[model samples]
Target: MAKVEQEAEVRYANADGLADALRGADALFVWDFLSTAVPDAWHAADRLRWLHIASAGVDPVLFPELRSSDVVLTNSRGVFDTPIAEYVLGVILAFAKDLMRSYDLQREKRWQHRETERLGGKRALVVGTGPIGRAIATTLRAAGMEVSGAGRSYRANDAHFGTVYPTDELSEHVGSADYVIAIAPLTEQTSGMFDRHVFRAMKNGARFINVGRGELAVTGDLIEALDTGQLGGAALDVFDNEPLPADSPLWTMPHVLVSPHMSGDVVGWRDSLVEIFVDNFTRWAAGEPLRNVVDKDLGYVPTGTSRV
Candidate 1:
């Protein structure tokens, strides 16, 4: 970024020195999206006018100080859409083809043949209508699955989602979907939204996938659902507590696939994030509206807004 913006002075600081570093900065680029340092250092932001985060989800940075401040906040929204969508499709295919079991058999040198489920005509309900969720729906649809979406409100005709049901109708939809994918943001109303009732409402053999915030799901409820055979399997990318605690039972679940929260990351993701910040910085310096400006109160970039 410094290479392109030669006239700008860049200051670097870790979480420990962030408060001191923000004393007189004009602009801030939070490269470490997971850090909770911003809120702690916000009081020192005397000259800060613009803040750009190198991530799509802004939950980590949506502290009261920043949310109520006048400082413009932007994020790398479009950067993660395609990569995460592709990751969702890969996992779906892995489940349908029983690839994990095949790999286990191969490692054991055992000749085991099994019937794998077909992807065609399966129903998938994506729980977020954001770009990432839309991308996943589109890719799943193209793979011969029927797709629908659920959002904060109902929309008769969304550009990407043919029909979007309101959050209130989620339980009704869950019972029928073969795959229930949670990719919604972390908001007041959505936190811990998926609990025992939601899981029990799902189809008996449905598979659950979560690429959304970890707090959105109830871990104990999910475990009960899986153990009781209410759910066939689960693929979890995010967890309530990251690194997911070594003693967590999810690690030993045969029907569960656990991964670090990296669905949106791909090769050169850091470069892509930097490119977004640089472009937005150019616009900010010129007093022009920046790209991926988040609706701080909503915790996401509003729908239908054009992105660079």
Candidate 2:
């Protein structure tokens, strides 16, 4: 911020001050990606030309008005890919080894020995084929999992994911996977995608992991699936509602591991996020195309865009 602020006038705004701050702003940096103040303050954005969000998903910032406008939208894409992928792999290993159960036994001062599942021969189906999903596939493959992908369309012989299935047909293909992971962005076509039908289609005792937006899965249906033993376990980092309300059953459910939405937020992540915005700001000031520019129509950065 110091580097960019030295060259351009920077205005800081919390949700309340956003409308006043955006009145004459030419470009806006949405450091708080989850704030819903932009849509309410749209009337004040008279001269805004560029907007950059600090997170990969732009659903919270892609209001109807901005989607239709000429203002270029960009995101901090490359920063989270590898960190999130490693987090996914860590949870997968934990599930297979029943680390949670061991911890519980230790707390109870009991000793028990049990065989654990092996990750090498397991099948994994990763939804979303963006850069983050590709990174996940690579990491899982390195650990010896037979990896596949589900995305907007079907493809074969891909580099990271061996075979990609169309997301619309995901239910038909999920039965074969030992682990099903969701890392897709939230969009009109993707919201509430992993519903009861999809859950029921998975092989009995298959585990589920989600590091993407919470809206990607139907919360009620997910609880039912776990309660009925249709799913062996679930390691969730995001939820339908943040802070996951106190009354939520997920917090006490057996075989369920709930984490705050910090899957990609490793140490120094904030600094890395700021660095990405600074680099893009330099490009914007030099009249060069910005990196990680999102395709608002698709609600994500396109495949051929400048992604690291």
Candidate 3:
């Protein structure tokens, strides 16, 4: 890497100091996970030729001005795939074995044994057939679970997923699923896409998992689905509101599990991201086409939300 060091100007560790380096930089790398502090800083400036965000989702950087610009954009897509797939596998197994129930039973000092479900033969509908989705399917299948992948378009006979359904057919497949996992991107069409109508359509006692954007699901409606017995269980790592209000009732919901959106994070997250940006940086410096370029119109259309 040092051989190409001279070709590189400055790589901002994050968006904080990114704007300051732009005047002397040919390309800028902004790994700002907290927010798109740089995109907002240089919206009207012409110095920024390309902007790279370290997050898998680019909604933070997709301001109207940046969207209308010719600046090249990219994201860290495959960096967190393995860890997130592992998280999903853990949740699937936990829910299937009623791990939470066993923990509660232990608290009561009960010595009762109960029949529990296995993931061996159950089917799962993994929405958004992107890198993260495909990784999840592969891991789930390895654990003996049948998988179905849903996406915007259907191709002939996809081997990874037992069934491939068009995006519009999502609700139909969801109705019969043992597990409906939302890993879809947050776009105009997907925003608030999972509401009362969609939840009420799922099979009785089926699990609904959302590692995607909070805007995709209605939080209050999710509570209603569980309360009404329409949904068996729900595990959410994201919420419409971050650092969820301390007073919200979701914290006390009986069948609901809430995570502060930490599913994709693991040891070495920052270094791993730095490595990916370094590789892509090399390509950008050489005038070669960059990978994982985000389509602003699609709004983070590339991969699933791994920072669940």
Candidate 4:
């Protein structure tokens, strides 16, 4: 705080306190990336030049006005990549070993033994080829899983994922994967991507894991798929309605694991997120190009754009 204040005047504002924080502000650091108050407060950002979000996903802060403006938008891209990849791997292992069911049995004081699935040699399809997805592919491969990728285009011999398929052709190849993981950025083309069709296309008893934005999957379709056994189980860290209404059936689903959007949040995660902003802030003050500059049109930070 002292260092930032020494650099320039700092105006603090939460979601509701932004009435005047953006007025004449040259830069803004959005720590509350999920807050929609920015759009309502956008009118006050007259002299704003740079806006940085403290999260990998910039969708929350990338409002239409900001997108059309001259302001440079940046995100804390690399901060959560490894953490999220690790979280996805944890979910995969939990599913393969049926750890959740074991925990339930333990709570009921029942002694039961069940055959568990093996992780090694199992096929995994990772959607999205960004840093997080790439990290997941690498980690899964290290765990002896056969990992592939689905992204915007097809690529051969990717360093992490050997065969990267086009996301548009997901249904055609989704059935082959024993585990399907979604970690893509939220975009018009990706919203509701995991609908009934995609779920139905998966091989029976295959697991699904989503650490991406909630809107990526159709909640109803996912529930139906789980109910009808289209998917063996699901580990959802995000949801269409956060706090996941108490009445939602997903809560009690035997095969579903509902997490509160904390997949990338490991211990001391806040400090890591803050470091990105502070480093970028130092660059901003020195007139150097900022890292994690997002391509608003594409809704993410494009590859090879993060400068040293």
Best candidate according to lDDT: 2
For each candidate in the order shown, give its overall lDDT on alpha carbons: 0.89, 0.93, 0.77, 0.90
| Collision pairs in model 2 | none
- Best first by TM-score, ranked: 2, 4, 1, 3
Over 171-247, each residue of candidate 4 has an lDDT whose tens digit, in order, gives 99899999999999998889999999999999999999999988999999999999999899999999988889999
- Weakest 10 consecutive residues, lDDT, candidate 4? 299-308
Per-residue accuracy of model 2 over 1-308 as CA lDDT, tens digit each: 99899989999999899999999998999987888888888899999999999998899988889999999999999888999999999999999999999999999999999999999989999999999999999999999999999999999998889899999998999999989999998999999999999999999999999999999999999999999999999999999898799999999999999999999999999999999999999999999999999999999998877984
Candidate 3 lowest-lDDT run of ten: 299-308
Which residue pairs clash within candidate 3? none
Per-residue lDDT over 1-308 for candidate 1, one digit per residue giving the tens place of the 0 to 100 score: 77645968778899999999999999999999888899888889998988999988889998888888898889888888888989888898899999999999999999988999999999999999888999998999999999989999988877777889887667877888899889998888788888999999999989999998888889999999999999999999999998899999999997899999999889999999999988887877788888988999898899888585
Q: Against the hidden reference, what TM-scores do the models get?
A: 0.97, 0.99, 0.89, 0.98
Over 4 Å off, model 2: none
Runs of candidate 4 exceeding 4 Å displacement = none
Stretches of candidate 1 exceeding 4 Å from the true structure: 3-5
Model 1 poorest ten-residue lDDT run: 1-10
